[model samples]
Target: MSDRDTIHAHIEAHIGEHIANIQRLVQQPSVSLEKTGLRECAALLVSNMMAAGFTEAETVDVGDDYPGVWGMVDCGKPTTMLIYGHYDVRPVGTEAWTHPPFSGEAIPFDGFPKVVLGRGAAAQKGPLQAWINAVSSILSVEGALPVNLIFLIEGAELLGSPNYGKLFERYRDRLAQVSALYGPKTAQDASGAVSMTLGYKGLIYLEFVASTQSTGLGPQGGAVHSATSVVVDNPVWRLLHAMASLTDDTGRTIAIPELAAMMAQAKPIADWERPLLDAMRAGVAGKDPNGFIPGLAPQFPVKTFKEEVAPADLLQRYMYGPSFNISGLRSGYTGPGTKSFLLPDTATATCDLRVISEVGAQDIIAIIRRHLDSAGFPDITIRVMAAYDWYQTSLESSLIRATLATLDAYDCPRTIWPVQGFGGPWAHFAKLLGIPSLQGGSPGHGARLATSDEFLVVEGDGKVASLATIERYYVDLIYAFAAVTKQ
Candidate 1:
C-alpha cells in the first residue's frame, strides 16, 4: 500500500483510542490565571507525545508558575516541521453552564449526538487533542511519520505568555531546525463552510492610573462635604479630560501622536478583505461611519453598516492594523444613591492596544508615556499589563500549500483568511523563534468558546472531525510535509 494509504489506515484503526485520550486531556483543568492543573496538563501532553512515537519528550521548566512542553520525532531529514499550540486556558468567567466545567462528560443528547462539555472545548483543548490524536493514529498505522516533527506547547497563553520570551530564547537552536510550521484551519462562516487561517493579529495591553494628592481640608484626608466643590479641582475630572484628549467624538481618530505615528506604518489592508467588508456593511447598516461608535459600530463605515457586516471585513479589522480601546475605568461614588464627593486621590483606566506588525509593548508604553507627558498629563502612570507579538506566514509558503492540500484531501471547503481579527501572543512562536504559527483549529460547529455552555460534538462513530474527514486531513498533512521537506 502507498505510504499515504497506510497512514490513513492507522488513523482509522485507533480512532476510538484517540477520542478517549482527547477526553482525558480536556478533563484536566489547566486554567493559567488560577494556576489550576497547569503542570499536570503539561505532563499529560508529554505523555501523549511520547505515546505518539516522540522519543524525546520533556517539559521545559522556565520557572514562574507553568512551564512549556517540548518534544520531537526525528526522521533524520534536513526539513523539520514545528507545531505551536497552548496548553493553558482562561478563567471560567461568571456563566452558568449546562454541564460541570471540567467534567469531560461525553453524554448523549436528546435530539443530537453525544458531546464533551468542559472547559477549553473551543478556546483550544479540543483542537490540541485532535493534533495529538492525529499523531498517535499515524504512528499506529505507519510505525513512523514521514517528516521530522517538533512540538512547542505553552502553559500560560491566557496570561499573555509572560515567560514565553525566556522559553523561546532558551530553545532557539531547536526552533531554528524547522523548515515549515503547521497550524489548524480556523476559517469558518455562520453557514458552516470551513476555511484555513493564515495569520493572527498581535496585542499589547496597558493600565494607566492617574493620581493626585488627597484633596481635602482635614488632616486625616476625609472627603469634604458638597460645599467644597467650587474650590477643589476634582481628580476625576482631571483624569477624564486627560483621557478625552486621546480620542475625539468618533473613536476612529486617535489623538495620541506616537500611536498615530506607529499606525501610519501599518500594512495596508489586504485584498481578500474587501468582499467580506462589503458583506458586513450589508448586514448592519444602522450607524454613521464618520461618528465615533462603541461596540461593533466602529468596524463598519456608516455606508457599509447600511449594507451588511460582512464576515470578511469583521475578520480583517481584527487580524490586521492597530486597534485602541479603553477596556475599563474606575473613579468614584454610587454607593446606595449619590454620595456627594469627587474622588480625592485617583482615577484609573485600562487600555488595550492591538498591534499588527512590529509594535512592541515596552516601546509602545514608552511612546504613550511620552505622549501623555507632552499632553500635560504627566501624572498618568503607565503599566504594561500584557504584551503579545504579531505572527504571520506567507500564503505562498510551503507550509500553507501543505495545509491547503490537506483541506482538499478531506474535501473541507477552503476559504482563505489572511489573518484572524483577535490578536494573540503567537509572536512568541513566530518572531521570537522564527517558527511559523497559525491559529486555526477544528473547534467544530456551535462550540461556544469563553461562555459556560462550551461543548464539543461527538458523533456516535467517535470521529472528532467525522471519522473519514479527519483521517484525510491528518494523512494529507503527513504526506505534504514529508514531500515538502524531502525537497
Candidate 2:
C-alpha cells in the first residue's frame, strides 16, 4: 500500500481513539477570557502531544495568567512547519444549550450521522485534536512523519493576543527555524462545500471614553442637571458625533476618504487569486454561494442584512472590506426609570475596526485620531484596547502550492476567499519570525463556534469530510508541504 494509504488505514483503525480524545479535550474547559481551565488544558495538550510522538511537549508561561502549550516533533528533516492554534475556547455563558457546554457528546444531530457537541467542537478543540490524531496515525504507520512539526497552542487568542510579546520572547529562536506557519481551520460549509482562505484581516479595538476630566467634555465635575443641557456640552453627543463620522449613512462604507483610499489601494486582488475569489463568489460545483453565509435567509426577523447596512457584494466586502463596529456604548443610568434629569459624568464607547493588509494598526489609530481631532472632537480620547495588523501568505510560495495541492487532491468542490474578514495575530509569525503564514485545514463540516450548541460533524453524508477524512487530509498535507517546500 502507498504510505498515505497506510496512514489512512491507521487513522481508521484508531478512529475511536480520535473521537474519545477529542471529547476529552473538549470536556476540559479552557476559556481564556474567563481564566478558567487554561493551564489545565495546556497540560492536557502537553500529555497528548507527547503521546502523539512529539519529541518535546510542554506548557510555557505566556507572561502570566494563561499559559501556552508548545510541542515539536523532530523528524530530522530540514523542512519544519508550525501549526498555529488556540487551545483556549470562548466563554460558555448562561445560555441554555442542547447539551452541557463541556459534555462533548457524540450523537446524530442536524442531518449529520454523528457529531461531537461541545464549546470548542466547531471552533477549535475538534480541529486541534484532529491534527494530533493525524500525527499519531502517521507515526503509528510510518514510525516518523515526512517533516518536522511544531505547535503553538495559544491560550489568549480571544484577548487580542496580549501574551504574544512574552510568548515570542520564549519561542523566538525556535520559531525562526521554521519554514512556514499554517492555521488549519479546514471547516466546511453546511452545504458540504469547503472554502479556502489565504489570509486574515487585522484588528484595532479602541475605546473612546468621554468625560468631564478625562476628555474635558460635558459638564464639569459630576453630572449637572439636564436643565443645563441647553448650554452645557454633552460628552455623549460629542462621542456620537466623532463615531458617526467614521462610516457613511449606510454604515458599511468608510466615510474617511484617506482610510477608504488606503483600503482600496491595498485591495488590488492578485491575478492568481482572482480566479479563486470568483469561484467562491460564483459558488462551486452547483452549490449556492449564499449557503456560505451564515444566519442569512430570504428573510429573518432579527434584522437581515441589506445593501444599505452591508455591502451588496458579499465576497468583495467580506474579503477586502474593513468593518467599523460599535461594540458597546454607555453614558447614562436607565436602571428603573428617569436618570435623564442628569447628565452622566462620562460616556464610553468601545469600537473596533477590522483592518486589512498593508494598513498597520498604529497607522490606522493615527488616522482615526487625526480624523477626530480635525473634526473638532479632540475632547474624545481614543484609548487603544487591542491592536494587531493583518497577515497573508504569498500565492507563489511552495507552501501555498502544497496547501492548494492537498485541497485539490480530495476532489471535493472547494471555494477560495482570497482573504478572510476575521482577525488573528498571524502577522507576528510573518514580521517577527519571517515565517509566512496561511490559515485553514482539512475538510470537516461544523457549526456554532462561540455560540450555543456547538458541534463538529463526525460522519459525512458522502460529501463533507468526516473526522477521519480530515485527519487523513492533514497527513497528506504534511507530506505534500514537505515535498514542495524542501530543497
Candidate 3:
C-alpha cells in the first residue's frame, strides 16, 4: 500500500479513539463568558497536543482574560501551516435540553443520523479534537508529519476575540514563518452539503442607551404610573422612535447617509463567485415549499423580505449585504401576565451591524451619532460593545488551491462561498499579518448553536456520517498542502 493509504488505514483504525477524545473535550465546560473551566480546558488541550507528537505545547497569557493555547510541531520540513480554532464556548443558559448540555451523550434516533448532543459539540470542540486526532494518527503511522504545524486555540472567540490581537502581536516574531491558516468546517446545510467559505463579513456591535439622567424629558427616579405618561415623556417610546428613524418602512434598508454610501460602494459580485452562487441558488430552489433554505432562510425569512427577490439576488444580499439588526431591546417588565403599568425611567436596546470591507465600527458609530443628533435625539448614547473588520483571500492562492484539491479528492460536494455572512477575527491573520487563510476541513452538521438542543453528528464512515469524513479529510489535507508548498 502507498504511504497515503497506510495513513488512512491508521485513521480508520482509531476512529473510536478519536471519538472518545472529542467526547472528553465536550464533557469539559469551558464557557469563556462565565470564566468557567477555561484554564483547565486549556491545560487539557496542551496535554493532548503533546501526546499527539508536538514538540512543545502550552497556554500563553493573552491578557487578564482567559489565556490562549499554543502548540508547535517542527517536522524538519520547509513549509509551515497554522491551524486556528477556539477553545471557548457560549454559556449554557437555563434552557431545556434532551440531554445535559455538557454530558457528551451519543444518542441515535430512528430517522436521523447518530449524534453527540452537547453545548460545544459542533460550534468548535468537536472539530478541534478531530484535528488533534488526525495529527496523532498521521504521526503514529508515518513516524513524522509532512510539514511543520502550529496550533493557536483561543478562549475568547465568543466574546469577539477581545485579546487575540494582542496575542498575535506578542507572538508575531515566532509566527512570522507561518505561510497559511486553515481550520475545520464548522457549518453544514440542511441538505447535508458542506461549504468552504473563503472569507467573512465584519461586525460592529453597539448599544443605544436612553435614560432620565441624561435627558430630563424622560421619567426620573422610578417608573411612574402609566397614567402619568400623558404628562411625562416615555423613554421607551423615545428610544423606539430613534430606532425607527435609522431604517425606512422596509426596515432592511438603512436610512443613515454614511451607511447607504458604504453599501453603494460595494463592488458587484465577481466572475469566480458565479458558479458557487448558482449552486447555492439551485440548493435554495430545491427546498420544500414550506422548508427554509439552510443559511439564508432561517435568518432572513421569506415573509420578512419587503419585495419578491430572486434566488441569486437573495444569495448576493446575504453574501455582500450590509445588515442592521436589533438583537435585543429592554425597558420595563416583560414577565408573565402583567405588572402595574408604569413608564420605565431607562430604556436600552442592543444592535449589531454586519459590515463589508469598506466600512468600520467607528465610522458607523460616528454616523449614527450624527444621524441621531440631526434628527433631535442626541441624548441617546451609542456605546460600542465590540468590533472587528472582515477580510477575503485570493481563490488562486496556494492555500486555497490545496484545500480545493483536498476536498475534490475526498469526493465532498464542493460549494465555495466567496464570503460568509457572519463575523469573525479573520482580519488578524489574513489582512493584518498578511497571511492567506481559508476555512475548510471535516464534515459535520450542527444546528441551534448557542441555543438549546445543540448537537454534533457522530456516526460511522460514509458520505452521510461526519466522523469519518472529518478524519479522512484532515489526513488528505495535510498531504495535499505539503505537496502544494514543496520546497
Candidate 4:
C-alpha cells in the first residue's frame, strides 16, 4: 500500500481509542459558569497530552480561577508554532435540551455511528481531541513530528478569558518565541472545503440598566392599582419612548449624536476587508432555516432572507460598522396570565455594543453615557460589564502565506471564507507581539456549539480523514514558517 493509504488505515484503526478519549473528556463537566470540574478537566487534558507524546505538559493554575494547560513537543526543529485551544465551555441553558447537558451518552442512529451528547461536544472538546488524534497518527507513522509545537489549553475562555493577560505576561518570553498562533472556531465550506482566516474583529460587551422610581407613579407613591392608569405616567411607556429615540425604524442608524464620535474612531484595513467581503457571498448559498433552535430567532442579531443577503452590506456591517442591541429587558410581572398591573416601580434594560477596529470600549461607553444624558434620560444608570479593545491583522504578512499554504495543502475549497469576518482577540497577538495570528477550527459543521440536539456522527473514516486534514495543514504550516525564517 502507498504511504498515504497506510497512514489513513492506521488512523482509522485507532479511531475508537481517540473517540473514547473524547467521550471521557466530554463526560467530565467543565462548565465555567458553575465552576464545575474545571481543575479535574484540565488535569485530564494534561494527562492526555502526555500520553499523546507531549514531553513537557503541565497545568498552570490561575490563582482561584480555572487552570490553563500548557505543553510542548520538542520536534528538535528551530521553528515553533503556538497552538491555542480552550477546555472550558459555556453553561448549558437549563430549560430545554434533548439530553441531559452533562450526560455523555452516545445514541445510535441508522446510517451513522452513535453520537455522544453533551455541552462542549462540538464547541471545542471534539476538535481538540481530533487534533491530538491526528498528531498521534502522524507520530505512529513517521516516528517524529515535522516541527516544533507549543500547545496551550486554557480553561477560562467562557468567562471572557479574563486571566489571559496575566497568564500571557507570565509566559511572554516563551510565547514570544513562537512563529505563529492558531485558535478554535474555524469554518470550512458547505462541501467540506477549508479556508484560512487572515484577520478578525475585536469586541466589547456592556450592560445598561434604566429605572424610574416614584416619578412614574402619578405623584401618588403607594403602588397604585391598575385602574388608576389615567393619572399615572407608566414607566413602561416612558422607557419605550426613550428607547425609541436610540434607533430608527429599520435599525439602520443610531439616533444618538454620540454615535458619531464612536464612528470617527473606527479604521478599517483594506487588505482584510476585500477578501472577507468576497467570502460572505460565496460561503453559503442559502441560510439554513433549521440551523438555529425553534423560537430562538429573536436572539440572533439580525435575520436575513436570501433577497436581503447583500454581501457588501453584510461585510460592511461586520468590519467597519457598529451594532447596538438590547440583550434583555424586563419591567412588570412576566408569567402565564395577564394580571392588572401598575407601572413598575423600576424598569431596567441591558445593552451590548460590538465595536470594530479603532473603537475603544471606554470611548464607546462614554459616547453612550453622553447620548443618554443629552437625550434627557440622565437618571438612567449604565453599568459596564465586560470591556475589550478592537483588534485586526495585516493580510500581507508572511503569517498569511503560511496560513494560505496550509489551507491549500489541506484541499480547503476556494469558495469558503478566506478570513474571519467576525471579531475576537486578534489585537492581543497582532498589536502586542507585532506578529499576525489566525483563528480557524474544526467545530462548525454539526449542531453542537451553543445549540441543543447537538451530536457528532462518527463516520467510519471521518475521524481519520479529519485528523489527516489537520495534520497536513499543521505540518505545512511548520514548513512554511521554516522557509520564511530561512529567507
Candidate 5:
C-alpha cells in the first residue's frame, strides 16, 4: 500500500486509543471564567503532549493566575507552523445538560452515531486533543512529521487573549522560525461540507454596570422595598434604558447613528476578500440554503437570517455588519422564584460588539460612552473587558492554499467564506507577531459550544467524518502545508 494509505489505515487501527486521548482531555475541567481547574488542566496537557512525542512541553507563567501551555516537536523539518488553541473554556452555569458537562462520554446522538458531550468539546478541548493524536499517528507511521510544530495554547482566550503579548515576548527567539498561525475550529456541517474562512470579525467585550455607588441615585443601604422604587431611582431600570438606547425595541439594528454611519463609510469589500466572496456566492449559497452559518443554522436547521434573505445580502450582513448583544444580565430576583419585594443596589449587563475591519474597538467604546452620557445616563459605567479589531489573510498565502488543497484531497466539499461573524484574538496577535493566519479543521461536526450539551461527533454517517478520518485528515494537512512552504 502507498505510504499515505498506510497512514490513514494506521489512524483507524488505533482509533480507540485516539478517542480515549480526546476523552481524557475533555474530562479535565478548565473553565477560564471561574478560574477553575486551569493549572491542573495545563499540567494534564503537558503530560499529554509529552506522551504524544513532543520534544518539550510545559506551561509558562504569563504574569497572571492563568498560565499559557507551550509544546514543540522537532522532526528536523525546515518549515515550522504554529498551532493556536485555547486551553480555557467558557463557564458552564447552572444550565441543564444531556450529560454532565465534563463527562466526555461517547453517547449515542440522534443524527450522528456517537458524540463526546462536554463543555469544551468543539471549542477547544476536543479539537486540541485530536490535533495531538494526529501528530502522534504521523510519527508512528512515517517515523517523522512532515513539518515541525509549535503549540501555543492560551488559558485566557475568553478574556480576549490579553496574555498573548507576554507570551510573544517570552518566546520571541523560538517563535522567529514560525511561518504562520493555524487556529483550528471544528468546521464541518452534517453534510460534511467545511468552510475556508479568510478572515474573522473583531470583538469588543464589555460590561455595563450601574449601582448605587456608581450612580448615587439608587437605594443606598442595600435592600429596599419595591414600594420605595417610586421615589428611589432604580439602577436596573436606568441601565436597561441605557441599553435600550443602543438598539431599538426589537434589538436587531444598532440605534447609535455614529456606529451605523461608521459601518456605512467602511470599505464595502477588501481586495483579498473578492475571490473568496465570489466563490461563496456560487458555492455556499448553492450547496446549502442557509449559506455556511456554521454550528447554528446547518446543525439545528433554524432561520438565522431574515426570512428569504438572498445569499448576497445575507453574506453582506454577516461579513460587515456591526452588532451589540447582551450576553448576560443580572440584578436581583432571578432565582427559582421571584423576590418581588427586594430591590438590589446594583445591576450588570455583559455585552459584546462585533466589528469589521473598517470599524475600531476604541471607536466603538468611545461611541458607546458618548451615547450613554448624551442619553442622560452619565453614571452608568462601561466596563471594558476585552477588545480587538478584525483581520484577513490572502487566499494565495501558502498556508491557505495548502489547507484548501488538503481539503480537496480529502474529498470534503469546501465553501470559501470571505469573512464570518465569529470573533477571535488570532488576527490581532498573529499580525502583531508578523505571521499569516489560517483557521480550519477536519471533517467532523460539533455543536453547542459556550452552552449546554456541547459535543463533538466521534462517529459519522457516510457524509460526516469519523474521529479516525478527522485525525488522518490532519496528518495530510501537515504534509500538504509542508510541501507548499518549500515553494
Candidate 6:
C-alpha cells in the first residue's frame, strides 16, 4: 500500500482513541473571558502535543492576557504548515442545557446520528484534537509526516485575540518561514454542505454613551418623576434620536455619507468572490437562509427581509455588505416587572460595525465621530471596546487548492466562500505575517458555537456525516496539503 493508504488505515485503527482524547480535551473548561482553567488547559495541550511527537511545545505568555501554546515538529520536509486554533471558548451564559456544558457526552439525536455535546466541542477543541490525532497516527505509522508542522493555539480568541498580533510579531522569523496556515472551518449553511471560507470581514466594537454630564441633553440628576419629562430631556430619547441618524428608515443601510463612501472605496467584489456569491444565491433560492438562525428574519427591515430579497441582492447585502448593529442598549430601570415614572440620567448603546477589508477600526471610529459632530451631537462619547482587521486568502493559493482537492476526494458536498460574514483575528497571521491561510476541516454541521447548547457531531461510521466527519477530514487535509508543492 502507498504511504497515504497506510496513514488512512492508521487513522481508522486509532479512531476510538482519538475520540476519547478529544472528549478529555473538551472536558477541560478554558473560558477565555472568565480565565477559567486557561493555564491548565494550555499545559494539557502542551503535554498532548509532546505525546504527538512534536519536538518542542510550550505555553507562551502574552502579557497579562491568557497564555498561547506553541508547538513544532520538524520532519526534514521541504515545506512547513502553520496551524492556528483557539483554546478558549465563549462564556456559557444563562441557557438551560440538556447536559453539562463541559461534559463531552456523546448523545444520539435524531438529525445528527451521534454528537459530542460540550462547550468547545465543535467551535474548536474537537477539531484541534482531531488534528493532533491525525499527526499521531501519521507519525506512529510512518515515523514522519510529509511536511514540517508548527502549531500556535491561543487562549484569547473569544476575547478578540487582543494579544495574538503581539505573539505573531514576537515570533515573526520562525513563523515567516511557514508556507501556509490552517484553521478549522466552523461555518456551515442550512444546506449542510461543508464550506471553506477564504477570508473574514473586519470588526469594530464600540459603545456610545450619552449622559447629562457629557451630552448635556438629559436630566442632570439621577431619577426624576415621569411628570418632569415636560421640562427635563430624556437621555434615552436623545441617544435614540442620535442613533436614528446613523441608519435609514430601513435600518439596514448606513445613513452616514462618509462611512458609506469608505465602504464603497474599500470593498469591491472581485472575480475570486464569484463562486461564493453563486453558492449564496443557490442557498437563498433553495432554503430559507434565515431558518437556521431563529428569530433573525424578523429583525431585518421589511424590504431587506430574506423572503422579499432576490438571491444576488441578498448575498450582496448580507455577505459583502457592511453593517451597523446595536448589540445592546442600557438606560433607566431594567427590573423584572416594570418600574416606570422616572427619567434616567444616562443612556448607553453598545454597537459594532462589521467592516470590510478596506476600512480600519480607528478610521471607522473617526468617521463616526465626524458624522456625530456634524449632526450636532458632538458631546456623545464613542469608546472603542475592541477591533479586528479583516483577512482574505487567495483563491488560487496552494492551501485553497489542496483543501478543494481533499473535499472533492471525499465526495463531500462543499461550498467555496470568498469570505466569512463574521469577524475573526485571522489577520494576525494571514495578513500580518504574509502567510496564506484557509479554513478547512471536517463537517461542523450542527455545532451551535457560542450558544448554550454548543456541541460537536460524531458520526457512527467514522465518516463525514453530521457528527462523524472531523477526524477523517483532518486526515485527508493533511495528506492533500502535503502533496502541494510550495510555489
What's the residue-level lDDT of 93 in candidate 5? Answer: 64
Model 1: lDDT equals 0.66
Ranking by lDDT: 5, 2, 3, 6, 1, 4
How many residue pairs collide in each prediction?
A: 23, 4, 0, 4, 0, 6
lDDT of each: 0.66, 0.80, 0.78, 0.63, 0.81, 0.76
TM-scores, each model vs. reference: 0.79, 0.86, 0.85, 0.74, 0.86, 0.83
True lDDT of residue 228, candidate 1: 65
Candidate 1 lDDT, 307-395, residue by residue in tens: 25544344345456467888788766546777664535566787787777576666777787888889988877777756776677766
| Cα lDDT of model 6 by residue, 213-279, tens digit | 8866556768778898888888887789899999899787789998887777657778767767776
Identify the runs in model 5 with alpha carbons over 4 angstroms from their true place.
1-10, 33-36, 61-66, 75-77, 89-101, 111-114, 141-144, 156-176, 248-252, 255-257, 270-272, 282-292, 295-312, 333-336, 373-378, 448-454
lDDT of 2 by residue, 1-487 (tens): 8888988998998898999999999999998878999989999999999888889999998568889888998989888999888888888866679889899999998888999999988778888889999999988888888999989878988777767657766888888888888777845877666766677788787799777786565667778888888878778877777778888987878888778888776567778877777766555334433544533442323344445332226546666877888878988785776666887778898887887757688898998888888878787788876677887777777777887788789876666566777776777887666667877745898887756888998888788889999988989889999889765
Tens digits of per-residue lDDT, candidate 4, 1-487, equal 9654565577678866877887888888898878999999999998888888886889988786678888888778776777778888878864488678767666653233466567887667866776676666667777666667788777877666656666677688987877777664435423464444555545555544445453433433334566667866666666666677788876666777767655666564466566666656454335443232122343464465323545445444454566676767876666678756555555667665665646466677787788777888776666655556655546566666666665566555533233343444445666677776776633223344676655444442342224334434444455566676566
> Relative to the unseen true structure, what is the C-alpha lDDT of residue 465 in candidate 2, on a scale of 0 to 100?
82
Model number with the top lDDT: 5
Model 5 C-alpha lDDT per residue in residues 354-468, reported as the tens digit of each score: 8785557777799889988898988988887777778877778888888888888888887777777877767655566666787774577888785689899999888888888
Model 4 quality (TM-score):
0.74
Instruction: Tell me the lDDT of model 3 at 95.
Output: 74
On lDDT, the stronger of 1 and 5 is 5
Q: Give the TM-score of candidate 6.
A: 0.83
Candidate 3 structure lDDT: 0.78
Instruction: Give the range where candidate 1 is weakest over 10 consecutive residues by summed lDDT.
Output: 290-299
Q: Give the TM-score of candidate 3.
A: 0.85
